[model samples]
Target chain A: MLIWNRAKILYIKKINWHLCLIFAAISSQPILTSMTWKQVFSSSIGRKLTMGLTGIFLITFLIVHMGINACMWAAVYFKDDHGEMFNKAANFMGSMVVIRIIEFGLFFFIFLHIIQGYMLTVYNRSKRAVGYAVDYGSKGSKWYSRSMGLLGTLILLFLIIHWLHFWIPSRFTGVEEVEYNGVKMHNMFALMQTTFQQLWVVILYVLGCISLGYHLAHGFQSAFKTIGVHNKRYQTMLTGLGYAFAIVVPFVFAMMPITMYLGWVK
Target chain B: MEHYNMSLHLKVWRQNNSRDKGHFENYKVDGISSEMSFLEMFDVLNERLITEGKEPIAFDHDCREGICGMCSMYINGKPHGPWKSNTVCQLHMRAYKDGDTIVVEPWRANAFPVIKDLMVDRSAFDRIVQAGGYISVNTGNAVDGNSLPIEKDKADASFAAAMCIGCGACVAACKNSSAMLFLSAKVAHLALLPQGEPERKKRVVSMVAQMDKEGFGACTNTGACEATCPKDISLSNIARLNQEYLIASLTADK
Candidate 1:
């Protein structure tokens, strides 16, 4: 009887060990699958999904950016403060830990977007091994839709210049700081005013905004369409909103440099 | 009725098989009637080639009235020629000028390998369809047509999607050679109907997996597919497919 009981306990232990092994393997399946770079990035659909998600995130970032920059116009309405509101808003954004973390995410997403955009463009070109004998330009689709790669590249160049002018100095190097109520903050408003003073700089900013407008014109609704928002009524509404947002946000961004350069805001 | 005759220069792609190197072999066909369809003109060219004891250009065509969706020819730079909502079979020669040089070629995509000169193996489409294109139901006495009362708008939308003839025009027209439009059409056709409810989740997931497996490119929503679609299939169908796939991915057991 004692021998049988010991044998039964040993058998139970073996079965439990096997069950644990199976369960562990099953639970680790997702992690293993995610570790595969090819499964995530190599497929065409995977690349597209990445593009759409990143594009939408960038669009959201643009809205927040435009909102902060529009604070310059607050001085125009409230003349007593002299762009104080804009400075405070800028300082709060720079100091916040959460926003700072998100800022890192934003850079990561932008880099991914750029890399994926170039990859898709190359893949698309390779799909057509030979060029068409006759050019069917603009007849098949909108010129802007086909020229996303070009527009995206232009925007990327603009971003580098803009970052050099503002972001790099504000973050890493010392910049003109203003102490407002004992809180020392980088005077981004002053930086913008000084930067826009140059005619070439102002022109480049405007051109960059124009490229952004065209990019958003196609990208806004396209992201929605990509993720499967296809109701006719909703589509019409999204398209209308897209057009308005594309034109309005970029226009506001472009106007800031112009107004600053012209000394209208001051 | 009056008919006008014109002489035309043709640069058609000729590949003996999938392995053979293909090249443009130019042939001149004179006194061609403007009333003849594009395929009819090809038939005239093929007849002449046969009489000369030369290897005739092989192309796919059946149901010359355009419903079969078998005829695919890349004319000039556009798929199915330069007309809107027109297939190669339905495209009349009158659209061309007397001294025009028409460049004809096969649908070029990695997924669509050339079987001959103008015939591409579109069996990728068949495999995609086989992946889960049908609803699951046991065969029995026919169910009453009126048993399921579908909404009018939904039915209309489904019918529009069902109009897809499985022609690979959308694939050929896409810059990326994506088949989202085609796959979406198939998904929407069944998803709109009540009979398709049981297998709806499985259908979308499996079909999309199959589509990706076939080595087709991703859809960028450039609208070229909608623009060049002979059936005038909307890009909205693609949106529906996306919606379906997302829902399935989240809710389906698999």
Candidate 2:
């Protein structure tokens, strides 16, 4: 690690004089240097801050995921060709070295989120060793707001099913390849069509989408609030925007499987 | 409203100390007036217990008017009982019907350990407050309030945040037992004013650090704190604290 740091500093020297100084200044900051893993994970405020940052990253990934898949609709409606646009989009995303490198960061963030979430759930439960005897449910807060852990667990399960169904096939085990306009790519659209043929798969996907919606409903505005958007005016705007995104993004995603199962996107 | 007397069954938590695993002790009280406060009803039960050669149940209370925030009762699975924006002392017997069985417990956060019965040691809150809940001022004549030109809206918001009475109701109501609402209320109470401008950044950072050190849980945006707060402290203060912490963390010169 020391050697890597020296090498990186030397490399920065070759880049620009001002860039080297800025890098030096940034590297010397005490907050980054002083923070330990135990402190990061154990501190309640620090953990929540981590949740906010990671949650925002995942929220952005959803948009990208939905947008890339929406290529199928564009292919069908615009070009009167099935799976052409989607396959091309998938192949481009899959083949890029830069994208592949970023994929590691994506996975790291995803795992960090899930691990931190579980850790917090466990730790928070320990705060109240014994709960109230009388069951007063949802009077003080919204049920969904309090049920983030359950919703998150559901989303995690959905992600596992999703990885099994699509991510594994595309990344590890090769899917059937088809050439579209002289470029060979994994026929992910065809694979999706075949997968959606099963009623249970479609049902599971819809359930996953519903869980995602509720999770995002709380998580969207929550991320911003955690990062310090706490005023009444901006807060109201973000909340309204968050609820809309929660409904729309998940609806669009749920429609992906529905359209395929109904043969509307073949 | 028609006033009437009623008989009620009580399942009050009784513990000798923080270490002891407490149990609910049942007591039946007759001819309790609806006009009496909930604490008054407890007074009746304690009187009965002492006469019967039994120990009186211990609980904390002062300024039964709800301002001191000393009464920490988790009655019927809620902090400060069934009334909206109310403390247990302010809660009347009229809220319940005859023969109603009330389950009372203390603030069950790890930070606020049970002293005995329904009373818990809440010095954790004082420590958090000490961390950075005030503005450093010189010992001199009081500053003129009119000299400080402050916005009306911000002042109102600041005053609202200042209304937090150092109660653990927010923690009691929270599933995670988070002190975010309470801590944030403290942070915002000072942060919104010019007097707090000098230590604005340090106040939030240190307070949050103290809060985390105190073994409180993180806020999950459940809104339970706001709903059950007797002072009606808004959850928006928590959001403001988040923003303040983020800014402070990012820009800390040291």
Candidate 3:
């Protein structure tokens, strides 16, 4: 054990792992070291890996949030006193500890996702600064795929507004409502109905959902491919799945707002 | 492949450099064999031109076997000619018939500076690779390959990446002149293995830095690289590269 310790000390002393750690830490930091454009757009997997993981996580969050929102639909459709249910659910969730935890998680996920995405876009743009002389004619490719960064920025903006308007009030505002059966409900239906009724809000939500759909169309299959699921058996099916998710999620989510506007869901 | 006669008109692009304007020069060749490989047919044309005491048309080629990946030229507006799994040299005259007016030109990209005629300097790619493309394995280490039991699927995936010849055909084929396919191959090769984990973040960051310096375009996910590749490298590789880069940029040591 003594000899091993000595060897380890020698190894550390020789290679200076601490220095490497510092360098790596500095390089990895978003503020300290921004990636060059080549690094961002250099590899197929690199690009997809970034886009895919963030997309999966973001989409997962969206689905969960949408599911929660869909509870309002349940209340509206079932003809129950869902106002009470909403109050109970919101009060239970509004507990100090739970709200804090949820807030931290949301912040961490969104911040990391956006920071990475921004760096990648910057790298991509910078790398292609010089123009090509000859036209190789690889055009007629999909449009949405190329415009991910722009679409992502739009989504980010939506996320910021969403969190500011909804998440913040629900969490840090210290507001109270009701609790039932160990669940908190915050008159969310009323909040949503009133908020979503505004013309600009509805328009923005529609646009955001569309952008999310477009983002998912490329991002879904891209994630599958990133996780190394690229056999003939899965490729076509996976691609089909991407299209389905991209189209279905937005369509379903958008339906709620449209229905709300059309008075279909009360 | 059996020899057959083919009479074709060749419209080849001639350019001195980025500063010079380029145009097409046409040549008529008769009694060609469809069985002859595309490069071999060029050889025949060059021979005819040499005998006629004219400057032979210039093009690029290194390994005729398609392994070295040095040859890259757009034939009739298609990168690496019309074959699915072929390089410019591996392309056969059989892809065309008699009297076909084939147009040939070098890949156009500001990143890929031209040397002369159909030969463009692709050393920009070399710089990208040198800038943290490899796994940073020290020489004389003599590590056993099996010492690290990589998953079979991962091994196969790495093998696919290892097949990239750095031909720049992917960039040439891209409308955006994107090197996403090329960079993706390198990233996929390293990212699939455990040995590559140690330097993964640095590798991605540096390689991308080098790629940007080289002036390659962003990937639009058009997948032209897969279409034009002589080795049939996948666009999925590009996706993989993007994911790795994102992860690295997001959650690096910091």
- Candidate with the greatest DockQ versus the true structure: 2
Q: Where does the lowest 10-residue lDDT sum fall in candidate 1 chain A?
A: A26-35
Please, what are the lDDT tens digits per residue for candidate 1 over residues B1-254? 56899999999999999898789999999989999999999999999999999999999999988788999998998899989998999999999879999999899888888999999998788667656676555556998978889999989999999999988999988877888899999999999998788768767766777777786778888899999999999999988887787666555443
TM-score of each: 0.89, 0.90, 0.64
Model 1: DockQ vs. true structure: 0.24
| Ordering by DockQ | 2, 1, 3
Model 2 misplaced stretches (Cα beyond 4 Å): A1-42, A75-79
lDDT of 3 by residue, B204-246 (tens): 7777767755777556565667877877787877756765766
Which segments of model 1 are wrong by more than 4 Å? Answer: A1-46, A77-80
Across all candidates, what is each one's fraction of true contacts kept? Answer: 0.49, 0.62, 0.18
How far out, in Å, is residue A174 in model 1? 1.7
lDDT, model 1, position A248: 98
Each model's lDDT: 0.84, 0.85, 0.71
Tens digits of per-residue lDDT for model 2 on B197-218?
A: 8878767777777787788888
- The candidate that achieves the highest lDDT relative to the unseen native structure: 2
- How big is the positional error of residue A67 in model 2, measured in Å on the Cα after superposition? 1.4
Question: Candidate 3: where is the Cα deviation over 4 Å?
Answer: A1-53, A81-119, A125-143, A153-207, A221-244, B1-13, B18-57, B63-65, B75-78, B93-105, B108-111, B124-161, B174-224, B234-254
